[model samples]
Each structure stands twice: as C-alpha cells, then as structure tokens.
Target chain A: MSVSTVRPDVYAQVQHFYARQMQALDAGRFADYANTFTEDGTFQHSPGAQPAVGRAGIVAELERFHERFADDPVQRRHWFNHVALEPLPDGSLSSTVYALIVTVRPGGTPKIGPSCVVHDVLEITEEGVLTRSRLVTHDQEAA
Target chain B: MSVSTVRPDVYAQVQHFYARQMQALDAGRFADYANTFTEDGTFQHSPGAQPAVGRAGIVAELERFHERFADDPVQRRHWFNHVALEPLPDGSLSSTVYALIVTVRPGGTPKIGPSCVVHDVLEITEEGVLTRSRLVTHDQEAA
Candidate 1:
C-alpha cells in the first residue's frame, strides 16, 4: 500500500496559507500578501523574467498590479486549485498549484486570464508561518 | 543547502511521457495515447466524474473528443508544464502538472481553454513503460 510521507498537518498548513494569500491579493491587501513570503522571497512571473525579490520588492510588484484594476471596472479573482505539497530533505516543502485568473467587468462576460502553474519553495519561519521563496514559472519572455 | 530527493532520471522520464502523450493526442493517435496507460488505468476529467477505465475506454473517449474538431478548422494544443514527480514507497511515482489547452479556429483569435492541474499516479510496467492510473483533477464538473 502506497501512502504519502508528508504529514497531514503539513498539508493543512500549506492549504490554509494559500487560501489566505489569495484572499489578501483579491482584497488588494498587498502588504498582507507580501507578508506571506520570507524576507528574501522571490516571485518569478515567468521563466525568463526578472523575479521580484524580497518582501519590499514583492509588495511593489503587487501594488503595481493592483493599480491596473483600481480605476477600471475590472476585478480579478485568482483561483488556485489542485495544490500538492511535498516535504523536501532540508525541512522546507515544495508545492505546485494551478492558478486560474478570472476577469470580471460590468456588462461584459467573465474572461479567463492566462492559466499558469506556480511551483513554490516554502519554508516555515521562526513564527511558524509558511513563507514562500520562489514562485510562478511561465513561458513569457523577460520584461 | 537543499537538494531534491527525486532523481534527474525520474524527471527526464516524466517529461518524456508527457511530451509523447501530448504529441500522440495532437497527431490524432488515440491508440498511442491510450497505450500509455495500464490495462486497468483510469482517466478522470474532473473531480466528481466517472472515469474512463481501461485502455479501450480511454481510446473511445479520446476518439470522440477528436471527432469534435475533425471537420472544423479548429486545432487543439495541450501544453503540460511545471511537472513535479515524487517517488512513492510502493515503487510508483506521483506527478502533478499544469495543463493549458489552446484552441485556434480558422480566421479567429486563438483562445485559451480551462487551465487546470492534473495529478497522475504512474507506475512502471514490467516492460519498463510508464503507465498512468488516475489523471486530471479540475474544478469543473465532469462532462
């Protein structure tokens, strides 16, 4: 019988972290979302693009993203599903999740944005919070 | 310092399997795609749907799917990326991949279909072929 080596609690913590992170982003709480990462966390929008490193950098990038939809009537909802987390050798965990971004506008049908996969390297901070190190791998060229 | 427990060869194999499977589907080789599965393998299109069990069932389902675009000037390309594989204690390997399906129609803008995640349970057969057991876990209801 094949059984998962990861503890059930680890899965629970990872899931909850993702849920809260998405909520913070959808609520335009850039600071809260950035707090989910480590001090030197990184968010790579695509494979060849420059990653936004550190909490400050992440917040800056997300703030700019939120600014795009601020004046417009468009709302973006990020749906992350089918998350799989595995414990790595050094105690940090690796996770993969598929993100579906839905764009909603007044008098317009909801449109789905680019579907991409995010592979995350997560570590538990001293506060026992799950913090991301690297995330999001896409096919786009570097900015 | 962190190192992956999954070997380099394992990643190579998983990547090759997805590449071949997608090629087979795109080339309309339903049989070839079906043959990638075990005799009693299953394909689940969504979370709560009846899976197409066995090779014959897989072939039949895929053939019907192919027929939908046969006469139309539509092309479907399945891109599987961000693949993560973990070795199970029972010798089987578990993998998660994000799939982006692009649909292109004659004289129409190419559209992206549902972006979803697929968690596959793969086992190597006696003949050293990677065979999948369960595949495709999406948020949408089963068709």
Candidate 2:
C-alpha cells in the first residue's frame, strides 16, 4: 500500500486551521471564520493589479456574503483543494489551499456556485493563530 | 468546530493534483510530477503574456528543474490563495487559482528564495488528468 505520509502532525495542523475557516462559513458562522486572520493580514481576490486590503476590508467584503444570502439556507458545504505546505525559516509552516465551496439553497437543488483558487501564505503564530497573506483568483465572475 | 463547505469537487481535486505534483518534485520525482497533466497541457509562468504550450513544452521547461537539483533536499513550495472555483454546465470544473510559490535552495542557508505569484486555469479531464488550456487570459498579462 502506498501509505500517504503527508506528515499529518505538522502539516495537518496547518490544514486544520484552514479547515476551520471553511467549516465556519459552511455553518453560517462567518464572524468566527473571519476572525481567523491576524489584524494586519490581507485578503485579496486578485494579487497585483488590485486587492481588498486588510482585516476591515476582509470583514466588510465577507459581510456581503451573508447579506447576499441573508434569506438563503443556513446549511452548506465548502471543499478545498490543491493544498500545499512548506516550512518557513522561522520554524513555521505555510500553505496554499483551494476548495470547491457549495452552498445548498434551501428547498432547492444544490447549485454549483462561484469557485475560487487561492494563493495563501500563512504561518502558525506564537498564539497558534494563522497569520496569512491571501490572493484570490476568480475563475467565475459574479453573476 | 467550524468546517469549510466550499463548492465543487473538481476544484479540490485539481488543487490536490497540483499539490501532489509539488510534493513529487520535492521528492526528486520530476518526471512523475510532470506526467500528471494531459499530453497537451500548457504552463504559463512569468507575468503571463505568453504560455509554454503543449505537454512537451511544459515538460521541456520543467525538466530544467531536474537538471538544476541534485536531490530531494531542495524544496520549492507553491502556496495558493483566494481561489475561485467555477462549476461549468458541462460538469467539468473551470478554475482560477492564484498562487504564491516560494522556492528553497538546497544550501545550508535553507532560508527562502524569491517567490512568484501566478494565476492559472485548469481543465480537469474525464479520465482524471488536469490540463491547462492553450489560450491565455486577458488579465494574465497585467500581473
């Protein structure tokens, strides 16, 4: 058997941090998920040209999600992929992950929504929080 | 207790495949890593204007990685960020994945090398292979 020795201990923790973000969002716990980042961290949909900067921007942008789905279903699932991990010189682990996040519209078929492929640079902070610089590439434009 | 509930399965699978490719390269398995894509996959590095087309083109470029590295100690990690996964009506996943790739040279320093952030699109085949389109994106040239 080709055992997948993905070093779950060190890298697994990194993935778990990411998993939390997805879980919170799926559970309609956006506030909890948004707080996962550091105060000075960034979340940019597009990297170089233009990006929504900082925590406030991130939080505000995330708000649109809930607002858009204010009357939508509370249950959903977010799947991520292309997760890559690397150990930094500071003895911390960083990773990049992508996932297909599906929000099941209540009382309707589970329609495939917007897909995102992200570039994330994160380190496990002293307090164990993940501090990251994120750049999101949008494959599907807003409908 | 929060979990990520992203949309689309192919997006995650594509990301998984990309991550696996990097891992294989770190293990000194370049050929194996390169073979993960279709025979006509295109690879665009730089700021994008032009892409290296065809599997042969992509392979020729990536082979340089093998020639440059002596062993597995050389680690190059590609971190991805804000991913947008789009589910096509045809059932395939159309994705825009933004990546921040940090490369580590094998020398004792082992600190960090320069990084490149790229936006790429992938077409996942019915047979489970991931392929890049020969066409380039309009914004790929900007940054």
Candidate 1 local lDDT, A1-143, one digit each (tens): 11224454555566678889888988778888888888888888777678898889999987876676677977778866555555779988877665657888899997864555578988965665556666664322121
iRMSD for each candidate structure, in the order shown: 10.7, 14.7
The docking quality of candidate 1, as DockQ, is 0.07
TM-score of chain B of 2: 0.62
Q: After superposition, how far is residue B90 of candidate 1 from its true place, in Å?
A: 22
**Fnat for every candidate:** 0.00, 0.15
Error of 1 at A10 (Å): 1.7
Which has the greatest lDDT? Answer: 1
In candidate 2, position B143 carries an lDDT of 42
Distance from true location, Cα of B94 in model 1, Å = 21
The Cα error of candidate 1 at residue B63, in Å, is 11
Pairs clashing within candidate 1:
none
Docking class of 1: incorrect
Query: What are the candidates' C-alpha RMSDs?
Result: 10.8, 15.6
